[model samples]
Target: MCGIVGAIAERNVTGILVEGLKRLEYRGYDSSGIAVLDSGAIHRVRRVGRVAAMEEAALAENTNGQLGIGHTRWATHGGVTEPNAHPHVSGELIAVVHNGIIENHDHKRDELKGQGYAFTSQTDTEVIAHLVHRHYVQDQDLFAAVQRAVKELEGAYAIAVIARDNPDLLVVARMGCPLLIGVGEGENFVASDVSAVLSSTRRVMYLEEGDVARITRESVQVFDGTGAAVERKLHLSDVSLASLELGPYSHFMQKEIHEQPRALSDTIEQILAQGFGASLFDGDASILQGVKSVQIIACGTSFYAGSVARYWVESLTGLPCAVEIASEYRYREAVASPDNLIVTISQSGETLDTMEALKYAKSLGQNRTLSICNVRESALPRFSAAVFYTKAGAEIGVASTKAFTTQLVALFALTVTLAKLNGRLTPEAEAGYLDALRHLPGSVQHALNLEPQIKAWSDRFAAKDHALFLGRGVHYPIAMEGALKLKEITYIHAEAYPAGELKHGPLALVDENMPVVVIAPNDALLEKVKSNMQEVRARGGEIFVFADLDSHFHDSEGVHVIRTPRHVGILSPIVHAVPVQLLAYHTALSRGTDVDKPRNLAKSVTVE
Candidate 1:
C-alpha cells in the first residue's frame, strides 16, 4: 500500500503538503514525492528515503505551489528508484499520484507506443497520465476525462489527478483501494487514511469504490463514473492527536505493545462497565444460531489471530470452523453450505485480500458474513452482514501488536456467544470464562510490566543472526506473531515452530548464535513447550521463556523466565504476546531500524 494525499489549499502550501505526507508515511516509505501546482505549472520533487529526507530536499529546492498531490510509495510495478516514484507527470498536461495497480498496463503501454507516446517511468501509473491526457484532449472535461480514462483501464486503483489546464480542480477516484475526502475550513484534502487529515479537519467523507471526487478550494463533490453526484456525510472520528504521539517510547511497536493493557481496557470497557455483554452477545447468538459451519478469513497478523481463534470457536461452540489465508482463499472457487457463516477479521478493515475473500464468499449465496474490525467506516463493515467493532484506537504500527491482542479478545467474546447459543457451555463453565475474560485487562497489564525485562534480554540478542520462537496449541499463534514482530522491525530472520515439531527440521538450526523464544505459560502445552526449550538449551541455543508465576520454571537453568499471570486455554496468548512484542521492539531499537515505519511495510495493505 502506497500513501497518497492531494490538497488544493488556500495559500502557497508546500509546507502543508509535506505535513500530509508525514502523516501518511505509515502507509509506505520506499520513496516520497510531492508536486505542487504553481503559476499554471507543476513543480515536482521526489527522493528515495524517509519523509523527513524528502521534506529537506523539497525545502532546499524551494518548490512552491498552492495546490498539489504527494505520495509515499511502496513499489509494486518497478524497482525503488526515482523513475518508479509517484507524482508522475505527463508533458505538463496531467500529473497523477496513484495507489494500487492497473493490471492491463502492459497491453495499454504497447497500444500507447503505437500512438507515439514514449514512456519515462517503468510503472503501470505512467500509463494513466497519458490516458488522462488523451481523454482531456477529446472531452476537455476534467471530471469526464479521468472518468473516461478509468473506464478504458482494468483492475484496482485509487488515483488523484491534477491537470495543468484545470489548475483549480482536482480529480480523485477509487476502485478497490481506499480514498477519503477531508473537509476543512476554506480548503479540502484527499488521502488514503483519515490519519493524514485528522489534525487538519475532523469532518471527513469516505469515498467508496466507483466513486469519483471533484475537489476545489471552496467546495467538494463526489460523483459516480456515470457522472451522477453521489451523497455521503462527514464522519467525525474519535481519534485524537495524542494517539499519534510517540509518547516517550523508543518505537510505536513498544508504545503499542505496552498499550495492550489500555487497548484491551478500551475494547472491553463498555461491555464490562454496563454489564451489557449479555445483550450484545445475546443478539449475536440469536443471529448466529443454527450455523452449521464457520469460516474465518484474514491476512497476515489478522490471519494469525483467526488461526488461534479457531481453537476457541470449536472448543467452546463445537462449531466446525476453518481458518483460511485471505489472499489465497479469494482466488479459489468454493461452495458454502446454506447458513454457513464466514467471519472476516481486519485491524484496518480495509485489507484488500480479506475484503476480496469476503466478497467471494458472499457471491456463493450460501453463507452470511460478519466483519470483526477496529475502524467503523472501513470497507469490511459496509459489505458484511454484521460487524463487531474492536475499539482499539488508531494503531499506527506497521506490524500490529495491540491490534492483534485486542482482536483475540473480541473473537473470544464472539466464541463465548456462540457457545451460549448452541447450549454447548454449562452455566458454571460460561460464568468462569466470562469472569476470566473480564480479568484479562488487568492480567494484560501485569504482563506488560514485564517489558523492561524483555527489553533487557533484547539487548543481548540484538546482534544474533537469527531466532526461533516455539509454542503449542493457542500459544502457537503468539509464537508466530512474535517471530513476525521481530522480522518486521529488526530485519532479522526468524521462524516460528510448533513446539511439538522441534524434533523435526527446525531443531537443526539451534546453535550458540541463535536465540529461541518460547511461550510456556501455564497450560496443557506448557510442559511440552518446556521440553522443546530444553532441547534448544541442550543444543546451546539461548532461551527466553515467558512462564506462569506458579510454574517451577524458576528452577530451570540456561533459560531466562519472565513470570506472568496464570491463564488457561484461549486467553494465554493475550499475556504471552506482550513480552514477544517487547523483545522485537527493543531489538529493532538497538539495531536502529525505523520501528514505526519499517522498511517495505505499511500499516494498511489496500492494494493486492
Candidate 2:
C-alpha cells in the first residue's frame, strides 16, 4: 500500500505535504514524491528512497504551491526508481498520485497509445494522468475529468489529482480503498490515513466507495457515484501525535508492545464501561439469536486471531465454526447459508482479499456479517452488519503486535456475548467472564513484565536458522501466530504444528540446531503437550517453553523455561501473544533487522 496526502490551503503547502508524507511513511517507504499546482503550472519531484530524500529534492527545486499532493510508495506496478515514483504528470496539465492497482491498466494503456498519448513510467498509475488529461481536453473541467477517467478503470484505488488550470482545488476519489478528508479552518486535507493529517486537523470525513470530493481552501463538497451530493459527518480523531512518536523506546514495535496494556484496556473498557448488561455487539441482538454456525474469513495475523476464535465459538456457543483464508475463500464455490454468521477480521480494515471475500459472501445472499477491526470508519466496518471496533489506535509496524492482541479481545467479547444470547452461558459464568475481562488490562501489563525474560531467551534464537513453535487446542493458533511473527521480522525459517501433528511429519526437521518454542498454557491438554515437548527433547531439539508459572515445567540442560504470569482461561491467547511478539521483536533487534518496516513488507495490504 502507498500513502497519499493532499492539501489545499491559503499558504504554501510544501512543508505540510512533506510532514504528512513523513507520518504516512510507515505505510510505504520504497519511494516518495510530491506534486504542486503553482502559478498556472504543475511542479513535480520524485525520489527513490525515503521521504527525507524526496523532501530534500523538493526543497532544492523550491517547489511551493497552495494546492498539492504527496505519496510514499511500496512499489507494485514498477521497480523502485525515480521514474516509477508517484506524482506522475501528463504533459504539463495534470498530476496524479495513486494507491492500489488498476487491473485494466494494460488495456487502457494500449487504447491511450492508439490515441498518441505517450507514457513515461512502467506504473499502472501513469495511465490515470493521461486518461484524466484526455477527459480534461474534452470537458475542460478537472472534477468532471476525474469522474470520467475513474469510470474507465477497474480494481482498488485512492487517488488525488491536481491540474494546472485548477490551482485552488484538489480532486480526490476512492474505489475499494481508504480515503478521507481532514477538516481545518480555512484549509482542508485528504489522506489515505488519519494519522497523516493529524498534525494539521483533527476533524475528518471518511469517504465511502465511489465517493469523490472537491476540496478547496474554504469548502469540501462530496458527491456519490450517481452524481448526487452526499453529506458526511466529521469525526474528531482521538489519536495524538505523541502516540506516534518513539518516546522512550528504540522502535515503534517496542513502543507498541508496551502500549498493549493501554490498548487492551481501551478495547475491553469499551465493553466494561457499558456495564455487564449492555450488548457487546453494537447492533441488534436478534442477529445473534438466529445464528447456527460461523464462517471466519481473514488473512495473515488476523486469520490466526480468527483461528483462536474458532476454538472459543465452538466450545462456548455450541456451534460449528470454520476458518477460511480470505483469498482462497473468494475463489471457491463454498456454500453459504442464511443461518451462518460471516465474520471478517483485519487491522487496516481495507484488506483486498478479505473485503472481496465478504462481498462474495454477500453476493451469495449471506447478509449476516460482522467485522472486528481497528478503524471505525474503514471499509470492513462500514460493510458489516455489526461493528466491533478494537480501538487499538494506529499500528504502524509492518509486523502486527497490538492489533492481533486487540482483535483477540474483540473476538473474545463476541464469543462471550453470543454464548449468553444462545442460552449457553449461565449467569454465574457470565459474571465471572465479565470480571475477568475487566482485569484484562492488568493481565496484559503482567505479560509485558515478562519481556525481560523473553528477551533473554531471544538471544538463543538470534543465531538460529530454523525454529518450530508448538501448541495444543486453542493455543495451536497462538503457536502459528508466534511462528509467523518470528519469520516475518527475523527472516528465520519457522514452522508451527499442533503438538499432535509433530509425529505426523514435522519431527524429522528437529535437531540441536532447531529451537522448539512451545506455548504450554496449563489447559486440560497440558500433560499431552508436555509429552510432546519430551518427544522434541528426545530428538536433541532444544526446547524453549513459554508456559504458565504454575505448569511446573522447569529448565534443564536442553529445556529452557520462560514462565508467564497465569491468566484467565479464555484470555490466555491475548496474554500468550504478548510474549511471542516480544520474542520476535527482541530476536529481530538482536539480529539488527528493521523491526518497524521489515524487508519487502508494507503495513497495510491494500493490494491483493
Candidate 3:
C-alpha cells in the first residue's frame, strides 16, 4: 500500500503536502515525491528514501504552489529507485499519484506506446498520467478526463490527478481502495487516511466504492459510478493528533507495548459496566440467538487473535468455531449457512484479504457479519452488520503490539456474552469474569514491570539464529504469536508447535543451538507441557520458559525460567503477551534492526 495526499488551497501547499505525507509514513515509506503545479507547469521532486529525504529535496527546490499531490510509495510494480518513485508527470502537463495496483497496466502501456506516448518510468502509476493527459487533450476538462481514464483502468486504485491547464482543480477517485476528503474553511484535501489531515480539519467525508470527487479551493463535488452527483455524510474524526506523538518512548512499538493496559481497559469498559451478557448484544439479540456456528476470518497478528478466540468461543458457548486465514479462505470454495456468523478481525480494518473473505462469505448467503476492528471508519466496519471497535488509538508500528492484545480483550468479552446467551454460563460466573476483567489492567501493568527480566533474556535470544516456541491449549496461539513477533521484527527464523506435537516431528531439529521457548501457563495441560520441556532437556535444548510462578519450574543450568505473575485463568493469553512483546522489542534493539518500521513490511495491507 502507498500513501497519497492532495491539497487544493489558496496559500502555498508545499509544507502541507510534506507534513501530510509524514503522517502517512506508516502506510508506506519505500520512496516519496511531490508534484506541485505552479505557473501552469508541474514542478516535481522525487527521492529513493523516506519522507525526510523527499522533504529535503522539495525544500532545496523551494517549490510553492496552491494545488499539489504527494505520494509515499511502497513500490509494488518496480524497484525502489528515483525513477520508480511516485508523482509521475506526463509531457509537462499532467501529474498523478496512485495507491494499489493496476492489473491491466501492461495492456494499457502497449496501447499508449502505439499512440506515440513515451514512458520514462516502469510504474503502473506513470501510465495513469499519460492516459489522463491523452483524454484531457480531447475533453479539456480535468474531472471528465480523470473519469474517462479511470474507466479504462482495472483493479484497485485511489488516484489523484492534477493538470497544468486546470491548475485550480484536483480530481481524485477510488475503486476497491480507501480515500477520504477533508473539509476546511478555504481549502480542501484528499488523502488515503484521515490522519494526514487531522491537524488542519476534524470534519471529513469518507468516499464510497467507485466514487470520484472534483475538489477546488472552496468546494467539493462527489459523483457516483453512474455520473450522478452524490452526497456523503461529513463525520467528525475522534482520533487526535496528540495520539501520534511518541511521548516518552523511543519507538512507536515501545509506546504501543506500554499502552496495552489503557487500550484494553477502554475497549471493554462500557460493555463490562453495563453487562457483558445482555448489553453486548443489546439490540442484536436476534442475530446471536439464531447463530448456529461462527467462522473467524483474519490475517497476520489478527489471525492469531482469532485462533485464541476460537478456543474460547467453542469452550464457552459450546458451539463449533473455525479460524481461517483470510487469504486462503477467499480463494477456495466454502460452505456456509444463513445461521452462521462471519466475524472478521483486523487492526486497520482495511486488510484486502480479510475484506475479500468477508465478501466471499456474504456471497454464500451468510449475511450475519461482525467486525472486531480498531478503526470505526475503515472498509470492514462499513461493510459488516455489527462492529466491536477496539480503542487502540493509533498503532504506527509495523509489528502490532497493542492492537493484538486489545483485540483479545474484545474477543474475550464477546465470548463471555455468547456463553451467557446460550445458557452455558451462570450469573455468579459472569460476575466473577467481570470482576477479573476489571482487574485485568492492574495485572497487565504488573506484567509490564517484568521488562528488566525480559531484557536480560533478550541478550541470549539475539545470539541465536533460530527459536522454537511451544505451548498447549489456548496458550498455543500465544506461542505462535510470540514466534511471529520475534521473526517479524528481528528477522530471526522462528517456529511454534503444540507441545504434544513436538514428539511427532520437530524434536529432531532441537539442540543446544536452538532456543526452545515454552508458554507454560498452569492450566490443565501443564503436566503434558512439562513433559515436553523434559523431552527438550533430554536433547540438550536451551529451555526459555515463560511460566506461571506456581508452575513449579525452577531455574537450572539450561532451563531458564521467567515466571510471570500467577496467570489469570481465562485471560492468561492477554497477560502472557506482554513478555513476548518485550522479548521481540529488546531482541530487535539488540540486533540493530528497525524496530518501528521493519523491512519490506507496511503497517496496513490495503491492496491484494
Error of 3 at 319 (Å): 0.7
Q: Each model's number of backbone clashes?
A: 0, 0, 0
Write the residue-wise lDDT of candidate 3 on 1-608 in tens digits: 88999999998999989999999998899999999988778999999889999999888889999999999988798899998899998889899999988999999999999999998888998889999999999968989999899999998889999998887799999987889999999999999888899878999999988899999988999999878999999999999898898989999999999999899889778877788754553224456665789999999999999999999999889889999999999999898889898889999888989998998999998988888889877889888877788888899888999999999988888788778778888989888898888988888898899999999999899998999999898999999999999999999999999999998999999999999999999899999998999999999999999988788889998999988988689999999988899999999999999998888888888877
- Better model by TM-score: candidate 1 vs candidate 3: 3
Candidate 1, after superposition: displacement of residue 187 in Å? 1.4
Write the number of the candidate with greater TM-score, choosing between 1 and 2. Answer: 2
| lDDT at 347, model 2 | 95
**TM-score of each prediction:** 0.96, 0.97, 0.98
Worst 10 residues of 2 by lDDT: 275-284
Which runs in model 3 stand beyond 4 Å of their true positions? 281-285
Q: Rank the candidates by TM-score, best first.
A: 3, 2, 1
Residue 251 alpha-carbon offset, candidate 2, angstroms: 1.1
Q: Which of candidates 2 and 3 is the stronger one according to TM-score?
A: 3
lDDT of 2 at 345: 97
Best by TM-score: 3
Which TM-score value belongs to model 3?
0.98
